[model samples]
Target: MWTINRFPGLWLLPALLPVILMTVYPIGHALWTSLHEVMILFPGEPFVGLRNYGRVVASNYFQDALRNSLVFTLFAAPSVVILGTLIALFLQRRFFGSHVVRSIVLLPWVLPGAISAVLWVWVFHPSFGILNGIMRDLGLIEDSILWLTNPRTALMAVTFAHVWTQIPFAVVLMMAALSTINSETLEAAAIDCRNPLKRFRYIIFPEIKAMIVVLLVYNALIAFTSYDLVYAMTGGGPGTATTLLSFQIWRESFSMYDFGAGSAVAFIVVVISAALIVAITRALPSDLFAGD
Candidate 1:
C-alpha cells in the first residue's frame, strides 16, 4: 500500500480538484463545443467540424469586438495604474486628511459592480444627470450629449467608468506593496544625495516593479473579461461601438443562438488572457520573492 505524505503538497490535490472541475472541464467542454454545431439553448443540432471556428475567425463582429477589447485594455489599465500609483504614493506619507482621502478613493472598490454600473448609467444620463448638466453649465458643451447613444464617445465613456471603478483596487494593492519598502534603504539613498525623483526612479520603482507588472496583467484580464460594465453602461449600442468580446460571446450564444461560435470566442479570450499572464510571470526574475 502506498501512502501520500501530508505536507503542503497534500493540499495540492484538493486545490487542483476544484481547478479541474470548474476550469479545466468547462474549458474542455467549450473546446469540444467549438468544434461542433452545439445547440446550447435548444435540442437536436448536427455536429459540424471547424466550420464555426472558420466563421468566427472571418466575421466582422468578432473583429470589432476584439479591437474594442484591445483598445479598452490599452487605455483603462494604464490609467488605473498611473492614477492608482499616484494616489498610493500620496497616501503613503502622513498628513492631515490623508486617511479621509484614502477612504474616499476606495469607495468604488467596495461597491458591487452592478450597483456601480447602474449608478454610472444615471450619472451619464443626457437630460438630468449630473455630468451633462455640469458640462453644459460650465459651457464645456453646446448642448447635452447622449453619452451612451453616440458611437464616437461611447467607448471613451465606458473606458472612463471602468478606469474609475478599477483604480481603487490598484490603489490599495500598490499601497500595500509600497509599505513593504525599507525606510533605511530609502534613507541610505537620501544620504547619497539622491533627489526624491531619483530615489523613486532607482530604489522605489525597482522594489515595486513586480507588483506593477502583476497589476497590469491582472487588470488586462479583468478588462478583457468585462461584460457587466459594458452591458449595463452601453448594452453594446449605439452601433456596436463599445461591444466587448464577453458581451459579444453572450450575444452569439443567447441572442443569435449560435452556441458553437460563442464557445469558440470564450475559449479564445481565455487563451489570450492566460498567455498574457504567463508572459508577465516569465518576465519577472525568480528572485522577486526571495527574502534578503
Candidate 2:
C-alpha cells in the first residue's frame, strides 16, 4: 500500500519545482550574496566574507531592531486572532446588511499593503492632519499629536494601522473555517439549553482550534516581516524605536550599502518565520483537512 509507485510522494516534490524556483532561488542567491560584500549602486565596491554578518551581530542597532520586531509580532498576532474571531462570529449570524458589511471590511485587505501604509502616513501627519482634526472636533485633543515622529507612540500608531488592515483578512479566513462546522450541531447546541457563551466555548471553539493556530502563525509571520508600514511612516526614525528587522535589512542594504549584512538579517527573519510556522503546525491536532 505504501509503495513508491502507489504513493507518488517522490514525484510530488518535483511537481513543486516551479514554486521552489520562485521562492527558493532568491533565498539561495541571497545566502550566497550574504557571504560576499559588494556594492553596485555606490562609488566604491569590494568583496568581503562573513564580516558583514559579524558586524550586524555585534551592532546594538540590529539587536534593537530584532527586539522591536518580536514585540510587534507578539502584540499584533494575538490581536488579529481574537478580534478577528469576534468580527467573524458576529458576521456569521443572519443580520441586515451583514454581507455588505463583510464586503466593506475586506476592502482594506484588497488594497496593496504599501498603499495602505502610505495612506496612513498622511493620516498621521501632525499639524493640520485629518487624525488630529478629528480629535479636535470630537474634543479628544487640543493639539495635533505627531504619531510617526514620536518614539513612544510610533510603534503603537503603526500597529494600529497594521491591525486595521489585517483584521479583514483574518475575518475572512476565520469565517471560512467557521463555515465548516456542522450547522446541525450548532442548531442542536441552541436546542440543548447552553447559553450563547457556553455554546461557543464548548462547541464552536474546539472545532476551530487547528485553524486558529494556523491563522495565528500566519499573522505572526506577517507582523514579523513588516516593512512597508514602518518604511512609509517612520523610516525607522525617532531613534530607531519603531524599526523592525525587515526595515533594518533594507537600510543596511540600500542606505548603508551593506548587502552582506542585509542578507544575513533576511536569512534570520526567514528562519524565524519558518520555525514559527512549523511550531504552530505541530501544535495543531492531526485531523486538520482530514475527515473524522
Candidate 3:
C-alpha cells in the first residue's frame, strides 16, 4: 500500500499526467510544427528550421492582422475598463430599484459572443438596421453608413461589439473588488475629500488598483485573441480591415491549410500574450498586492 511519505511523487502523477497530456503535449507539438514545413496538400511535415516563422512574419496578412489587433486592444480595453468601472460605481450606490438595473446591465455579457456578434451584424446593416435608422432620424447622416463593410469603420465596429461584451465582465470584477474595500475608509475619505475625484484618487483607487491591473491584462488578451465576433460579423472582409491575429491564424490553418505558418503565428501570439501578462503583473503597485 502507498504511504504518505513513501511515494509523494507517485501520488502527484494523476493530476500532473492530465496537464502534460492536454496542455504540454499540444504546446510542444505546436512548437515543433512551427519549426517545420507542415502541409496538408503534401506528404510528410519536413523540417524547415524557422522558415515558416520568417514567411509568416513577411506576409502582408500577418502585418495587417497584427496592426488591427493592436488597434482593437488600444481602444476596446480602455472602453471596457472605463465603462465597467462607471457602471459598477453606479450599481454600488444605494438607490431605489438598483438591483433591477444591475441585473439588466449583465444581459449583454451573459449573451453568447456569437449571438452578440450576430445581433450586431443586424445593428450595423446599411439600410434596415436600427442604428442607421436612428442616425437618419437624428439627422446625423443623410445616408446609411456601412459600418462593418467600410475599411475605416470596420475595425471600430468590431471593437465596439467586443467592448460591449467585455464591459459587463469588468463591472463584475470591479464590484467584487469594491466590496472588499472597507466602507469606513470610504466614509472617512468622503468627509476629508469632498470632491468625488479626490476621494477616488486617494481612497478608492488604492483598494481597487490590483483589480484594475488584472482587468487591463484580461481585456488586452481577450481583444488580441478576438475571433468569434470578427468571424460572425466581418468575416475579415473589406480588404482584411478587421482581420485580427487569432482570425488570421484560423484562416491560415483551416482555410488555407498551412499548418506550419498557422502554428508559427499561434506560438508568436502565445509569446506576446505571455509577455503582456508579465508586464502588467509587474506594473501593479507594490502595495496593491501586498498581504498584511
Pick the lDDT winner.
Answer: 3
TM-score, one value per model: 0.89, 0.87, 0.91
Off by over 4 Å in 1: 5-11, 40-42, 188-194, 278-292
lDDT by residue (205-257, candidate 3, tens digit) is: 87887788879999989988888989999899899899999998899899889
Backbone clashes in model 2, listed as residue pairs: none
Between candidates 1 and 3, which one is better according to TM-score? 3
* Candidate 2 Cα outliers beyond 4 Å, as residue runs: 1-10, 41-49, 137-140, 278-292
Candidate 2 lDDT over residue span 155-228, tens digit each: 99888888888899899889998999999999999999569899988899888877788779889999999988
- By summed lDDT, the worst window of 10 consecutive residues in model 2 runs over 38-47
Per-candidate total of colliding backbone pairs: 0, 0, 0
lDDT of 1: 0.87
Off by over 4 Å in 3: 1-18, 282-292
Clashes of 3: 0
At residue 273, what lDDT does model 1 achieve?
A: 86
